[model samples]
Target: MLKKNTQHEKVSHRKPVVLMSMGAQERKGHDYQVMTVKYIKPLAEHAGCVPLLAPTCCGSEDIEQYLSMVDGVYLTGAGSNIDPALYGQENLTPDKQQDPNRDNFDIPLIHAALKMGLPIFAICRGMQELNVALGGDLHQKLYAEPNMLDHREDGDESVDEQYADAHQVRLVSNSWLSKLLEAEEIPVNSLHGQSIKTLGAGVQVLAHAEDGAIEAIHLPEVEQFTLGVQWHPEWKAAQNPNSIKIFAAFGDACRLQVQARS
Candidate 1:
Protein backbone atom coordinates (compact mmCIF):
# COMPACT_ATOMS: atom_id res chain seq x y z
CA MET A 1 0.00 0.00 0.00
CA LEU A 2 1.63 3.26 -1.11
CA LYS A 3 -0.70 5.27 1.12
CA LYS A 4 -4.14 4.76 2.66
CA ASN A 5 -6.73 6.77 0.74
CA THR A 6 -7.94 9.29 3.34
CA GLN A 7 -11.27 9.83 1.58
CA HIS A 8 -12.02 6.12 1.53
CA GLU A 9 -11.04 5.73 5.16
CA LYS A 10 -13.80 8.16 6.17
CA VAL A 11 -16.66 5.88 5.00
CA SER A 12 -15.22 2.66 3.56
CA HIS A 13 -16.91 0.69 6.32
CA ARG A 14 -20.26 1.69 4.79
CA LYS A 15 -19.31 1.66 1.12
CA PRO A 16 -18.09 -1.35 -0.81
CA VAL A 17 -14.53 -1.08 -2.11
CA VAL A 18 -14.03 -1.25 -5.88
CA LEU A 19 -10.36 -1.92 -6.70
CA MET A 20 -9.67 0.25 -9.75
CA SER A 21 -6.76 -0.19 -12.18
CA MET A 22 -4.47 2.62 -13.38
CA GLY A 23 -2.06 2.90 -16.28
CA ALA A 24 1.63 2.33 -15.59
CA GLN A 25 3.09 5.82 -15.94
CA GLU A 26 6.63 4.96 -17.07
CA ARG A 27 7.58 8.43 -18.21
CA LYS A 28 9.41 10.96 -15.92
CA GLY A 29 11.17 8.11 -14.11
CA HIS A 30 9.10 4.95 -13.33
CA ASP A 31 6.12 4.94 -10.92
CA TYR A 32 2.64 3.43 -10.77
CA GLN A 33 -0.35 5.49 -11.92
CA VAL A 34 -2.45 3.03 -9.92
CA MET A 35 -5.75 4.85 -10.36
CA THR A 36 -6.81 8.22 -11.69
CA VAL A 37 -9.06 10.47 -9.55
CA LYS A 38 -11.02 11.33 -12.72
CA TYR A 39 -11.77 7.63 -13.27
CA ILE A 40 -11.83 6.35 -9.68
CA LYS A 41 -13.75 9.21 -8.04
CA PRO A 42 -16.85 8.65 -10.18
CA LEU A 43 -17.11 5.06 -8.94
CA ALA A 44 -16.97 6.37 -5.38
CA GLU A 45 -19.38 9.28 -5.90
CA HIS A 46 -21.88 8.22 -8.57
CA ALA A 47 -21.64 4.47 -8.11
CA GLY A 48 -21.60 4.65 -4.31
CA CYS A 49 -18.46 2.53 -3.98
CA VAL A 50 -15.16 3.21 -2.23
CA PRO A 51 -12.33 3.42 -4.75
CA LEU A 52 -8.97 1.77 -4.00
CA LEU A 53 -5.90 2.05 -6.22
CA ALA A 54 -4.51 -1.45 -6.97
CA PRO A 55 -0.79 -1.30 -7.61
CA THR A 56 0.73 -2.96 -10.72
CA CYS A 57 4.04 -4.19 -9.26
CA CYS A 58 2.93 -6.50 -6.47
CA GLY A 59 3.21 -10.26 -5.93
CA SER A 60 0.32 -12.77 -5.83
CA GLU A 61 0.15 -12.67 -2.04
CA ASP A 62 -0.07 -8.87 -2.07
CA ILE A 63 -2.80 -9.07 -4.75
CA GLU A 64 -4.73 -11.74 -2.83
CA GLN A 65 -4.36 -9.71 0.34
CA TYR A 66 -5.94 -6.63 -1.29
CA LEU A 67 -8.54 -8.68 -3.12
CA SER A 68 -9.80 -9.84 0.25
CA MET A 69 -10.44 -6.24 1.30
CA VAL A 70 -12.46 -5.07 -1.74
CA ASP A 71 -15.97 -6.03 -2.82
CA GLY A 72 -15.41 -5.50 -6.54
CA VAL A 73 -12.88 -4.56 -9.25
CA TYR A 74 -12.87 -1.75 -11.84
CA LEU A 75 -10.44 -1.89 -14.75
CA THR A 76 -9.73 1.39 -16.53
CA GLY A 77 -8.62 2.21 -20.03
CA ALA A 78 -4.86 2.58 -20.50
CA GLY A 79 -2.68 4.53 -22.96
CA SER A 80 -0.50 1.46 -23.51
CA ASN A 81 -1.50 -1.74 -25.29
CA ILE A 82 -1.38 -5.30 -23.84
CA ASP A 83 1.67 -7.28 -24.84
CA PRO A 84 0.51 -9.39 -27.85
CA ALA A 85 2.65 -12.35 -26.86
CA LEU A 86 0.28 -13.11 -23.96
CA TYR A 87 -2.46 -13.97 -26.44
CA GLY A 88 -0.15 -15.87 -28.85
CA GLN A 89 0.38 -12.98 -31.29
CA GLU A 90 3.25 -10.72 -32.31
CA ASN A 91 3.01 -6.94 -32.30
CA LEU A 92 2.35 -5.64 -35.78
CA THR A 93 4.17 -2.40 -35.08
CA PRO A 94 7.25 -1.72 -33.00
CA ASP A 95 6.00 1.80 -32.15
CA LYS A 96 3.41 0.57 -29.67
CA GLN A 97 3.96 1.10 -25.93
CA GLN A 98 3.26 -2.16 -24.10
CA ASP A 99 2.57 -2.91 -20.44
CA PRO A 100 3.76 -6.35 -19.31
CA ASN A 101 3.70 -5.06 -15.73
CA ARG A 102 0.00 -4.28 -15.84
CA ASP A 103 -0.66 -7.44 -17.83
CA ASN A 104 1.05 -9.53 -15.15
CA PHE A 105 -0.79 -7.76 -12.35
CA ASP A 106 -4.28 -7.34 -13.81
CA ILE A 107 -4.66 -10.75 -15.44
CA PRO A 108 -4.10 -12.50 -12.11
CA LEU A 109 -6.23 -9.93 -10.30
CA ILE A 110 -9.09 -10.44 -12.75
CA HIS A 111 -8.92 -14.22 -12.42
CA ALA A 112 -8.76 -14.00 -8.64
CA ALA A 113 -11.71 -11.62 -8.60
CA LEU A 114 -13.61 -13.92 -10.94
CA LYS A 115 -12.93 -16.85 -8.64
CA MET A 116 -14.20 -14.83 -5.70
CA GLY A 117 -17.37 -13.93 -7.65
CA LEU A 118 -16.74 -10.20 -7.23
CA PRO A 119 -18.57 -7.67 -9.39
CA ILE A 120 -16.43 -6.28 -12.24
CA PHE A 121 -16.82 -3.23 -14.46
CA ALA A 122 -14.25 -2.68 -17.21
CA ILE A 123 -13.64 -0.18 -20.02
CA CYS A 124 -11.50 0.16 -23.23
CA ARG A 125 -8.07 -1.38 -22.63
CA GLY A 126 -9.54 -2.99 -19.56
CA MET A 127 -12.23 -4.57 -21.72
CA GLN A 128 -9.65 -6.00 -24.11
CA GLU A 129 -7.66 -7.11 -21.11
CA LEU A 130 -10.66 -9.05 -19.78
CA ASN A 131 -10.76 -10.91 -23.07
CA VAL A 132 -7.07 -11.82 -23.17
CA ALA A 133 -7.14 -12.86 -19.53
CA LEU A 134 -9.92 -15.30 -20.33
CA GLY A 135 -8.19 -17.14 -23.17
CA GLY A 136 -9.26 -14.83 -26.00
CA ASP A 137 -7.25 -12.93 -28.61
CA LEU A 138 -7.22 -9.41 -30.17
CA HIS A 139 -6.54 -7.68 -33.49
CA GLN A 140 -3.27 -5.74 -33.15
CA LYS A 141 -4.38 -2.86 -35.41
CA LEU A 142 -7.94 -2.50 -36.69
CA TYR A 143 -6.85 0.12 -39.24
CA ALA A 144 -4.70 -2.40 -41.12
CA GLU A 145 -7.23 -5.23 -40.61
CA PRO A 146 -9.71 -5.72 -43.42
CA ASN A 147 -13.45 -5.01 -43.15
CA MET A 148 -13.31 -3.05 -39.85
CA LEU A 149 -14.03 0.57 -39.10
CA ASP A 150 -11.18 2.95 -38.29
CA HIS A 151 -12.13 3.45 -34.63
CA ARG A 152 -9.44 6.08 -33.95
CA GLU A 153 -10.28 9.77 -34.14
CA ASP A 154 -8.26 12.90 -35.00
CA GLY A 155 -5.37 13.11 -32.51
CA ASP A 156 -5.42 16.93 -32.50
CA GLU A 157 -9.04 17.24 -31.23
CA SER A 158 -9.46 18.05 -27.57
CA VAL A 159 -10.38 15.05 -25.36
CA ASP A 160 -13.87 16.41 -24.83
CA GLU A 161 -14.51 16.83 -28.55
CA GLN A 162 -12.94 13.46 -29.36
CA TYR A 163 -15.11 11.49 -26.91
CA ALA A 164 -18.35 13.21 -27.91
CA ASP A 165 -20.65 10.44 -29.20
CA ALA A 166 -18.91 9.15 -32.32
CA HIS A 167 -21.22 6.14 -33.00
CA GLN A 168 -24.21 4.11 -31.84
CA VAL A 169 -24.00 0.74 -30.01
CA ARG A 170 -26.80 -1.74 -30.62
CA LEU A 171 -27.67 -3.93 -27.66
CA VAL A 172 -27.89 -7.68 -28.06
CA SER A 173 -31.42 -9.06 -27.79
CA ASN A 174 -32.14 -10.89 -24.50
CA SER A 175 -28.75 -9.96 -23.09
CA TRP A 176 -28.11 -8.47 -19.66
CA LEU A 177 -27.42 -5.00 -21.11
CA SER A 178 -30.65 -5.06 -23.13
CA LYS A 179 -32.62 -5.75 -19.94
CA LEU A 180 -30.69 -3.12 -17.97
CA LEU A 181 -30.84 -0.13 -20.33
CA GLU A 182 -34.12 -1.20 -22.05
CA ALA A 183 -32.91 0.74 -25.09
CA GLU A 184 -32.43 -0.70 -28.56
CA GLU A 185 -29.36 1.41 -29.20
CA ILE A 186 -27.24 4.14 -27.63
CA PRO A 187 -24.56 6.55 -28.83
CA VAL A 188 -21.04 6.15 -27.37
CA ASN A 189 -17.72 7.93 -27.45
CA SER A 190 -15.16 5.98 -29.47
CA LEU A 191 -11.40 6.62 -28.98
CA HIS A 192 -9.59 3.32 -29.62
CA GLY A 193 -7.95 1.75 -32.67
CA GLN A 194 -7.72 -1.85 -31.38
CA SER A 195 -10.72 -4.15 -30.80
CA ILE A 196 -11.53 -7.72 -29.70
CA LYS A 197 -11.00 -10.21 -32.51
CA THR A 198 -12.23 -13.48 -31.00
CA LEU A 199 -14.93 -14.14 -28.46
CA GLY A 200 -13.58 -15.51 -25.15
CA ALA A 201 -14.95 -18.62 -23.44
CA GLY A 202 -17.83 -17.94 -21.03
CA VAL A 203 -17.99 -14.40 -22.43
CA GLN A 204 -21.09 -13.03 -24.10
CA VAL A 205 -21.00 -10.31 -26.74
CA LEU A 206 -23.54 -7.80 -25.47
CA ALA A 207 -23.17 -5.01 -28.02
CA HIS A 208 -21.47 -4.07 -31.28
CA ALA A 209 -20.41 -1.04 -33.34
CA GLU A 210 -22.23 -0.38 -36.61
CA ASP A 211 -19.18 -1.77 -38.42
CA GLY A 212 -19.36 -4.99 -36.31
CA ALA A 213 -16.55 -4.26 -33.85
CA ILE A 214 -17.18 -5.97 -30.51
CA GLU A 215 -18.33 -3.07 -28.33
CA ALA A 216 -19.41 -4.84 -25.13
CA ILE A 217 -19.07 -8.19 -23.30
CA HIS A 218 -20.70 -9.96 -20.36
CA LEU A 219 -19.92 -13.11 -18.40
CA PRO A 220 -23.18 -14.83 -17.55
CA GLU A 221 -21.98 -17.47 -15.10
CA VAL A 222 -20.68 -15.00 -12.53
CA GLU A 223 -22.72 -14.92 -9.33
CA GLN A 224 -22.66 -11.12 -9.41
CA PHE A 225 -22.00 -8.35 -11.96
CA THR A 226 -19.57 -8.76 -14.88
CA LEU A 227 -19.56 -6.29 -17.76
CA GLY A 228 -16.96 -4.71 -20.04
CA VAL A 229 -17.34 -2.03 -22.67
CA GLN A 230 -15.03 -0.84 -25.43
CA TRP A 231 -16.05 2.83 -25.15
CA HIS A 232 -15.47 5.01 -22.10
CA PRO A 233 -18.50 5.69 -19.89
CA GLU A 234 -16.48 7.18 -17.03
CA TRP A 235 -15.58 10.24 -19.15
CA LYS A 236 -18.96 11.87 -18.52
CA ALA A 237 -20.88 9.45 -16.32
CA ALA A 238 -23.07 12.02 -14.57
CA GLN A 239 -24.43 13.25 -17.90
CA ASN A 240 -25.03 9.78 -19.37
CA PRO A 241 -28.08 8.08 -17.91
CA ASN A 242 -27.01 4.67 -19.23
CA SER A 243 -23.58 4.97 -17.65
CA ILE A 244 -25.22 5.94 -14.39
CA LYS A 245 -27.48 2.91 -14.56
CA ILE A 246 -24.59 0.58 -15.36
CA PHE A 247 -22.47 1.83 -12.49
CA ALA A 248 -25.41 1.75 -10.12
CA ALA A 249 -26.15 -1.85 -10.99
CA PHE A 250 -22.51 -2.79 -10.46
CA GLY A 251 -22.44 -0.97 -7.15
CA ASP A 252 -25.64 -2.67 -6.02
CA ALA A 253 -24.24 -6.08 -6.91
CA CYS A 254 -21.11 -5.34 -4.94
CA ARG A 255 -23.13 -4.36 -1.91
CA LEU A 256 -25.17 -7.52 -2.13
CA GLN A 257 -21.98 -9.57 -2.24
CA VAL A 258 -20.69 -7.76 0.84
CA GLN A 259 -23.92 -8.43 2.72
CA ALA A 260 -23.73 -12.08 1.77
CA ARG A 261 -20.23 -12.32 3.19
CA SER A 262 -21.27 -10.66 6.40
Candidate 2:
Protein backbone atom coordinates (compact mmCIF):
# COMPACT_ATOMS: atom_id res chain seq x y z
CA MET A 1 0.00 0.00 0.00
CA LEU A 2 1.23 3.48 -0.88
CA LYS A 3 1.40 6.03 1.90
CA LYS A 4 -0.81 9.10 1.44
CA ASN A 5 -0.12 12.72 2.31
CA THR A 6 -2.63 14.85 4.21
CA GLN A 7 -1.03 18.28 4.31
CA HIS A 8 -1.36 19.16 0.62
CA GLU A 9 -5.07 19.76 0.25
CA LYS A 10 -5.25 21.90 -2.86
CA VAL A 11 -4.47 20.41 -6.28
CA SER A 12 -1.91 23.16 -6.84
CA HIS A 13 -0.12 21.91 -3.73
CA ARG A 14 0.40 18.64 -5.58
CA LYS A 15 3.51 19.27 -7.63
CA PRO A 16 4.00 16.86 -10.54
CA VAL A 17 7.63 16.69 -11.57
CA VAL A 18 8.11 16.62 -15.36
CA LEU A 19 11.28 14.91 -16.62
CA MET A 20 12.46 16.74 -19.76
CA SER A 21 15.52 16.19 -21.95
CA MET A 22 17.98 19.09 -22.23
CA GLY A 23 19.36 20.05 -25.61
CA ALA A 24 22.96 21.20 -25.70
CA GLN A 25 23.38 24.18 -27.98
CA GLU A 26 26.52 26.25 -28.38
CA ARG A 27 26.14 30.03 -28.56
CA LYS A 28 29.15 32.39 -28.58
CA GLY A 29 31.39 29.50 -27.47
CA HIS A 30 29.10 28.82 -24.48
CA ASP A 31 26.91 25.75 -23.94
CA TYR A 32 23.31 26.37 -22.96
CA GLN A 33 20.11 24.47 -22.19
CA VAL A 34 17.99 25.43 -25.24
CA MET A 35 14.56 23.73 -25.20
CA THR A 36 10.82 24.36 -25.82
CA VAL A 37 10.00 25.42 -22.24
CA LYS A 38 7.41 27.99 -23.31
CA TYR A 39 5.01 25.41 -24.73
CA ILE A 40 4.65 22.69 -22.05
CA LYS A 41 4.77 24.64 -18.78
CA PRO A 42 1.65 26.74 -19.36
CA LEU A 43 -0.39 23.79 -20.60
CA ALA A 44 0.60 21.80 -17.53
CA GLU A 45 -0.47 24.70 -15.32
CA HIS A 46 -3.74 24.97 -17.23
CA ALA A 47 -4.35 21.32 -16.45
CA GLY A 48 -4.19 22.13 -12.72
CA CYS A 49 -0.77 20.61 -12.13
CA VAL A 50 2.41 22.34 -11.04
CA PRO A 51 5.22 21.55 -13.44
CA LEU A 52 8.43 20.70 -11.60
CA LEU A 53 11.39 20.57 -13.97
CA ALA A 54 13.59 17.49 -13.57
CA PRO A 55 17.03 17.65 -15.15
CA THR A 56 18.04 14.97 -17.63
CA CYS A 57 21.43 14.45 -16.00
CA CYS A 58 21.92 14.30 -12.23
CA GLY A 59 24.29 12.84 -9.63
CA SER A 60 23.49 9.97 -7.20
CA GLU A 61 19.80 10.97 -6.91
CA ASP A 62 17.96 7.90 -8.11
CA ILE A 63 14.72 8.22 -10.11
CA GLU A 64 12.81 6.58 -7.23
CA GLN A 65 13.60 9.65 -5.12
CA TYR A 66 12.19 11.91 -7.82
CA LEU A 67 9.20 9.63 -8.50
CA SER A 68 8.38 9.39 -4.79
CA MET A 69 8.58 13.14 -4.48
CA VAL A 70 6.36 14.01 -7.46
CA ASP A 71 2.82 12.95 -8.36
CA GLY A 72 3.53 12.30 -12.08
CA VAL A 73 6.15 12.46 -14.85
CA TYR A 74 5.98 14.23 -18.21
CA LEU A 75 8.57 13.18 -20.81
CA THR A 76 8.94 16.19 -23.09
CA GLY A 77 10.00 16.09 -26.73
CA ALA A 78 13.59 16.49 -28.04
CA GLY A 79 15.55 16.37 -31.32
CA SER A 80 18.04 13.63 -30.48
CA ASN A 81 17.66 10.05 -31.69
CA ILE A 82 17.85 7.04 -29.37
CA ASP A 83 21.12 5.14 -29.59
CA PRO A 84 20.65 2.01 -31.70
CA ALA A 85 22.83 0.01 -29.32
CA LEU A 86 20.13 0.26 -26.67
CA TYR A 87 17.79 -1.74 -28.93
CA GLY A 88 20.48 -4.17 -30.23
CA GLN A 89 20.22 -2.66 -33.71
CA GLU A 90 23.12 -1.70 -35.99
CA ASN A 91 23.45 1.96 -36.80
CA LEU A 92 22.26 2.58 -40.33
CA THR A 93 23.61 6.09 -40.14
CA PRO A 94 25.26 7.77 -37.18
CA ASP A 95 23.19 10.63 -35.79
CA LYS A 96 25.86 13.00 -34.46
CA GLN A 97 23.07 15.14 -33.05
CA GLN A 98 22.45 12.61 -30.25
CA ASP A 99 22.78 13.89 -26.67
CA PRO A 100 24.46 11.27 -24.45
CA ASN A 101 23.74 13.18 -21.25
CA ARG A 102 19.96 13.24 -21.85
CA ASP A 103 20.09 9.60 -22.93
CA ASN A 104 21.72 8.55 -19.64
CA PHE A 105 19.18 10.57 -17.67
CA ASP A 106 16.10 9.32 -19.54
CA ILE A 107 17.03 5.60 -19.62
CA PRO A 108 17.44 5.21 -15.88
CA LEU A 109 14.49 7.47 -15.15
CA ILE A 110 12.31 5.45 -17.52
CA HIS A 111 13.35 2.18 -15.89
CA ALA A 112 12.68 3.54 -12.42
CA ALA A 113 9.30 5.02 -13.41
CA LEU A 114 8.12 1.74 -14.94
CA LYS A 115 9.31 -0.36 -12.01
CA MET A 116 7.60 1.95 -9.52
CA GLY A 117 4.41 2.27 -11.64
CA LEU A 118 4.48 6.07 -11.82
CA PRO A 119 2.13 7.93 -14.17
CA ILE A 120 3.97 9.13 -17.30
CA PHE A 121 2.94 11.20 -20.35
CA ALA A 122 5.32 11.16 -23.31
CA ILE A 123 5.37 13.19 -26.54
CA CYS A 124 7.34 12.90 -29.82
CA ARG A 125 10.91 11.88 -28.99
CA GLY A 126 9.79 11.28 -25.43
CA MET A 127 7.26 8.81 -26.86
CA GLN A 128 10.05 7.03 -28.73
CA GLU A 129 12.16 6.92 -25.59
CA LEU A 130 9.30 5.42 -23.58
CA ASN A 131 8.84 2.73 -26.22
CA VAL A 132 12.56 1.96 -26.42
CA ALA A 133 12.85 1.86 -22.65
CA LEU A 134 10.11 -0.78 -22.60
CA GLY A 135 12.05 -3.19 -24.92
CA GLY A 136 10.58 -1.75 -28.17
CA ASP A 137 12.45 -0.62 -31.32
CA LEU A 138 12.39 2.42 -33.64
CA HIS A 139 12.41 2.93 -37.42
CA GLN A 140 15.50 5.20 -37.08
CA LYS A 141 14.56 7.20 -40.19
CA LEU A 142 10.97 7.73 -41.27
CA TYR A 143 11.85 8.87 -44.78
CA ALA A 144 13.78 5.66 -45.33
CA GLU A 145 10.66 3.75 -44.52
CA PRO A 146 8.69 3.31 -47.72
CA ASN A 147 5.41 5.20 -48.30
CA MET A 148 5.64 7.22 -45.06
CA LEU A 149 4.78 10.92 -45.23
CA ASP A 150 7.33 13.60 -44.45
CA HIS A 151 6.69 14.27 -40.77
CA ARG A 152 9.22 16.96 -39.85
CA GLU A 153 8.00 20.07 -41.62
CA ASP A 154 8.40 23.55 -40.23
CA GLY A 155 6.30 26.31 -41.84
CA ASP A 156 9.38 27.96 -43.37
CA GLU A 157 13.12 28.10 -42.80
CA SER A 158 12.88 31.53 -41.15
CA VAL A 159 9.61 30.86 -39.37
CA ASP A 160 9.32 29.40 -35.86
CA GLU A 161 5.95 27.66 -36.26
CA GLN A 162 5.53 23.98 -37.03
CA TYR A 163 3.20 22.74 -39.77
CA ALA A 164 -0.37 22.72 -38.52
CA ASP A 165 -2.45 19.62 -39.24
CA ALA A 166 0.21 18.16 -41.49
CA HIS A 167 -1.04 14.67 -40.74
CA GLN A 168 -3.96 12.75 -39.24
CA VAL A 169 -3.90 9.91 -36.70
CA ARG A 170 -6.70 7.38 -36.29
CA LEU A 171 -7.33 6.12 -32.79
CA VAL A 172 -8.19 2.50 -32.10
CA SER A 173 -11.65 1.81 -30.73
CA ASN A 174 -12.03 0.90 -27.05
CA SER A 175 -8.46 2.13 -26.44
CA TRP A 176 -7.53 4.24 -23.46
CA LEU A 177 -6.46 7.11 -25.77
CA SER A 178 -9.79 7.03 -27.61
CA LYS A 179 -11.69 6.96 -24.33
CA LEU A 180 -9.68 9.91 -23.06
CA LEU A 181 -10.18 12.06 -26.15
CA GLU A 182 -13.67 10.73 -27.00
CA ALA A 183 -12.80 10.76 -30.68
CA GLU A 184 -11.92 8.49 -33.57
CA GLU A 185 -9.43 10.66 -35.44
CA ILE A 186 -7.27 13.58 -34.43
CA PRO A 187 -5.20 15.98 -36.50
CA VAL A 188 -1.71 16.64 -35.13
CA ASN A 189 1.57 18.37 -35.82
CA SER A 190 4.34 15.96 -36.71
CA LEU A 191 8.03 16.68 -36.13
CA HIS A 192 9.72 13.34 -35.70
CA GLY A 193 12.05 11.26 -37.88
CA GLN A 194 12.01 8.10 -35.76
CA SER A 195 8.95 5.99 -34.84
CA ILE A 196 8.01 2.87 -32.94
CA LYS A 197 8.91 -0.32 -34.86
CA THR A 198 7.98 -3.12 -32.45
CA LEU A 199 5.93 -2.36 -29.34
CA GLY A 200 7.51 -3.08 -25.96
CA ALA A 201 6.34 -5.72 -23.52
CA GLY A 202 2.74 -5.12 -22.25
CA VAL A 203 2.34 -1.98 -24.39
CA GLN A 204 -0.76 -1.46 -26.55
CA VAL A 205 -1.07 0.52 -29.77
CA LEU A 206 -3.71 3.20 -29.36
CA ALA A 207 -3.40 5.07 -32.65
CA HIS A 208 -1.77 4.77 -36.06
CA ALA A 209 -0.88 7.05 -38.91
CA GLU A 210 -2.44 6.68 -42.35
CA ASP A 211 0.72 5.02 -43.58
CA GLY A 212 0.72 2.53 -40.70
CA ALA A 213 3.20 4.25 -38.39
CA ILE A 214 2.55 3.80 -34.71
CA GLU A 215 1.19 7.10 -33.39
CA ALA A 216 0.31 6.22 -29.80
CA ILE A 217 1.14 3.59 -27.13
CA HIS A 218 -0.26 2.67 -23.70
CA LEU A 219 0.23 0.05 -20.98
CA PRO A 220 -2.99 -1.05 -19.26
CA GLU A 221 -1.69 -3.69 -16.83
CA VAL A 222 0.04 -1.23 -14.48
CA GLU A 223 -3.19 0.69 -13.71
CA GLN A 224 -1.17 3.90 -14.04
CA PHE A 225 -1.40 6.60 -16.69
CA THR A 226 1.48 5.74 -19.03
CA LEU A 227 0.76 6.99 -22.53
CA GLY A 228 2.95 8.14 -25.43
CA VAL A 229 2.02 9.94 -28.64
CA GLN A 230 4.17 10.50 -31.75
CA TRP A 231 2.76 13.97 -32.38
CA HIS A 232 3.16 17.21 -30.37
CA PRO A 233 0.12 17.51 -28.12
CA GLU A 234 1.56 20.50 -26.25
CA TRP A 235 1.45 22.56 -29.42
CA LYS A 236 -2.11 21.57 -30.20
CA ALA A 237 -3.44 21.58 -26.64
CA ALA A 238 -3.25 25.37 -26.49
CA GLN A 239 -6.04 25.72 -29.07
CA ASN A 240 -7.60 22.30 -29.47
CA PRO A 241 -10.15 21.16 -26.90
CA ASN A 242 -9.32 17.49 -27.37
CA SER A 243 -5.64 18.21 -26.86
CA ILE A 244 -6.50 19.99 -23.65
CA LYS A 245 -8.41 16.89 -22.55
CA ILE A 246 -5.33 14.79 -23.25
CA PHE A 247 -3.18 16.76 -20.82
CA ALA A 248 -6.03 17.24 -18.38
CA ALA A 249 -6.61 13.50 -18.27
CA PHE A 250 -2.93 12.95 -17.57
CA GLY A 251 -2.99 15.52 -14.80
CA ASP A 252 -6.13 14.02 -13.33
CA ALA A 253 -4.55 10.60 -13.36
CA CYS A 254 -1.56 11.98 -11.48
CA ARG A 255 -3.85 13.65 -8.99
CA LEU A 256 -5.64 10.36 -8.41
CA GLN A 257 -2.31 8.60 -7.89
CA VAL A 258 -1.35 11.21 -5.30
CA GLN A 259 -4.72 10.86 -3.58
CA ALA A 260 -4.41 7.07 -3.56
CA ARG A 261 -0.90 7.23 -2.14
CA SER A 262 -2.03 9.65 0.53
Winning candidate number (lDDT): 1
Instruction: Write down the lDDT that model 2 would get.
Output: 0.75
Per-model lDDT: 0.85, 0.75
Question: Candidate 1 lDDT, tens digit per residue, 1-262?
Answer: 4255664544444678888765667657867565666687679767899888866765445788888999999999987899988899988856977777789888998899999889899999999999999999998888777777788878999978998999999999877798899887999999897899997888889999998999999898777789999998888788889989988888998888667665
**Residue 3 lDDT in candidate 2:** 27
Each candidate's number of clashing pairs is 0, 4
* Runs with alpha carbons beyond 4 Å of true place in candidate 2: 1-17, 59-61, 154-161
| Candidate 1 runs further than 4 Å off | 1-13
Model 2, poorest ten-residue lDDT window? 1-10
lDDT by residue (tens digit), candidate 2, 59-178 = 425666767777777787776777888898987768446766676778778778777777888888888888888898988878688898777765464223574677789999977778
Weakest lDDT window of 10 consecutive positions for candidate 1: 1-10
lDDT assessment of candidate 1: 0.85
